[model samples]
Target: MQYLFRLSAIYVRHRRLALAFFCLLQAQAAVAGDLFHTDNADLYSRAFAVVPAAISGDTQLKFGDTPPNLRLRNSLIIGTGAALVAVYGSNNWWQSGFGGGFDTTNEGWFGSGTKFGGADKLGHAYINYAGVRLLTPLFESAGNNRDDSLSLALWSSLGIYTAVEVVDGFSHNWKFSPQDAIANVSGAVLGVALETHPGLDAMFDFRIDYRRSPRSPKFDPFGDYSAQKYLFVVKADGFASLRENSFLRYFEIAAGYGTGGYDTGGNHQRSTYAGLSLNLSRLLADDAYGGHMHATAFQRGTDRLFDLVQFPTIGYARRSLD
Candidate 1:
């Protein structure tokens, strides 16, 4: 009961922080527009139009518009905001017991112990993927070339993850994991690859889902894995050759992996699942309001809310307990 209460408090706090972050982004966008003397109406319109344009391959949907200064401005704003959150919002993981001196030891691939059954590693990858994809467009809007923006997004994501590891190296509770770093790099690479390839980007998405686990020791959402799963969803529209099949065009296939019983040595469980999902965004792309809502809602947030909320149509799971 105490753990549940603390977990709820942390969740609420994080939600508030997320809301504030969104507000900050909106404010930054407005300020950038004012500095460039760009009409606000045009900015908002273009923001809304970019989604459809990007999907339709319209020439007007160039990935850049603002000047270099604006790009730097937005980058600095976001970086600083993220740094603040990491330092302060991390429940003093950075400050508590800071005198441990950096240890150069490698914490094996599986994170010392199976505390979260490697779910945290998957969380890291998904976060890096989403971070790079989300920031790439912002960089482009700030007048960066598409390729350049992708590169920036990649490095920035990796850099942030690396910074966390560096901090962990100095902490007593956590040690650096090479596996986590690899996951971060892999995710960043995937994000860049998908962003550069329109067909693949449209066809596939990386997503994550979690449910509260009674077995979690602490209230830490990042570390809890009793009921967390990472997913790869294949969009139906990716099959351009099968466009005639309307039924197939509205459906997606998903594969997911998760683990449980990390805290128990011999009771660890590994699970894999295959499922069907609805392609909501593609299904509603023709509706102006729906398209705009889908694009804005998914793009502007770090979490892929739509994917997290959508339940799988039919799922089959296989589990192995060791």
Candidate 2:
């Protein structure tokens, strides 16, 4: 009886510590399992698997065949991409040409006519969407699950674009634009939505084309009206639910608009275009081409190559001066 009583006393004295130790074990197991499975599992398995293993000193747990420094690799990829954008794409913001004073005044809806009739806003949205979409696969390769990858990509794009806006605000030549910020957010949301439903990717695409304009204070791609055309393309292949037809599937419709002569003291001319476009991805889809035109390196290279050549389209123009 005395021995039993002593045993009970010991158990009571150590109860809290034992409970804490068990909880610690559970936490470690959960962390290990998440790390392991995120790097290895398929969609179905990732959704359902959460079994916690017992933590034994002799038990070895491996997080797939990934290097022990997977986090470092992810950081490097993100950092490199950010550095490139900051250095080349946004170098104008850091240059001494613009006065050093910050502009806190928000440019109501359309920024100081410098954005070339909302072309810059559309550019912002396109950047945000493309940034998130591009970063998502990198995040996934870096060990994040699909949901986490999408979240990270969205936040990362927002962060980069917000940083750009902050730099713009401080520049003497540019003021903060609420319209641009809204467009950026909208694009990020669209990117996340598309990523969650990849089937929708074929349905919508944001494309941009640029041409040199003779009337502009500076040759800025983002600000120059004479140089930018933003297109929202709807691919017919995206209508997979509406009975697949061979002829219609290879076509796309695009509506694009841009403006010029914003800074040149002339009337801001708007260019609206509507035209039939080819769905190169759908047209090239064949067993020989691996049917993954959207995901292949060859397809991406072709896209970049073709982007240099602006396709001809029929459009209407409003306002007189160029």
Top-scoring candidate (lDDT): 1
lDDT by residue (tens digit), candidate 2, 1-322? 9999999866654553333233223322322334333333344434444644665655444554443344444445555555555654334443433346657654444443444566667778878887787878777767666766776677767766775666567655677677778999998998888778767775777776666677655666655656787777777777875317867776777777776666566767766777577666565654347555656767765643332223543232333323
Deviation in Å, model 1, residue 31 alpha carbon: 21
Candidate 1 per-residue C-alpha lDDT over 1-322 given as tens digits, one digit per residue, 9 for 90 to 100: 9999999877766754554344334433422333333233444335434333244444344534444244344557456646564645355443333336766554444443555656777877887888788777776666666766676666667766776766567666677777778888888888878878977877788876666677655565455666677888887777876544867877888888878777433367777778787776655564444434235644434223454334544455665534
Q: What is the C-alpha local distance difference test score of each model?
A: 0.62, 0.61
- State each candidate's clash count: 0, 0
Residue pairs with backbone overlap in model 2: none
Measured over all alpha carbons after superposition, the RMSD of each candidate to the real structure, in angstroms, is 9.9, 17.7
- Stretch of 10 with least lDDT, candidate 2: 23-32
Q: What lDDT, from 0 to 1, does candidate 2 have?
A: 0.61
Clashing pairs in 1: none
